[model samples]
Target: MELGRLLLLQVFCAALDAGTTWLMWSRIDISVVLARIAGAFLAAILIVLFCRRAPEFRGIGRFLATSISLTCLLVSYGIFALLMLRNPVLQWPLAFAAASGASLLLSWIGYWRARQGRVSG
Candidate 1:
């Protein structure tokens, strides 16, 4: 995708994360908030910009990938960040890895489907 769109998406996701954090947590911490926001921003970029045939963003696979990636990031980092900053949690890394893996797999699905002439946004 274009740099402007990408940046706007990131900012939008960050704002969402921040707003969620504020709504959920009575006492907000810095590291945890940053981590969640960063994870969301990263997820959006990975699923959208880096998806198969990308910049073009077509296909059900792309849509699924975006949802899967965003969900993984929000659930994993958003929850784990609350505890990980105070004490290390192995699940945090594992969850982030899972987010990455899911995005990659979904992107591959999109790629294969597009190759099969099945790219319809």
Candidate 2:
């Protein structure tokens, strides 16, 4: 896929995840909701940056990529939120950065696997 389309997909996924997170958890605390939303965006951007042509994997692989992306977003936000609960100070940036880094690492691995020529599609 083209870069623009890939980015649009990421933004769409991030926005959907953020909207859902806000609707579900915004009642808890405004900060947590916003942080998780930001984390979701960061995960997509960082994943794209590290993964590059990761979206090229197609067929059923395309669905798997999207599923993994969503899963990673949730997991990354959950980890950041849990860590923030313990510190509750100036750790939001650090936690989000780490989460983005983790997402990047995960995407890089996926990109590697996608290029291994073993996947069906």
Model 2 poorest ten-residue lDDT run: 1-10
Q: Candidate 2, residue 94: CA error in Å?
A: 2.0
Count of backbone collisions within predicted model 1: 0
Model 2 agreement with the true structure over 26-90: per-residue lDDT tens digits = 56666764646654675566555544555454423555566556666777676677777777775
Structure candidate 1, residue pairs in collision:
none
Q: lDDT (0-100) at residue 53 of candidate 1?
A: 47
Write model 1 residue lDDT over 28-66, tens digit each, in one string. Answer: 554444545654665456556554545544334556545
Instruction: Supply the global lDDT for candidate 2.
Output: 0.57
TM-score versus the correct structure, for each prediction: 0.36, 0.52
| Model 2: lDDT of residue 4 | 42
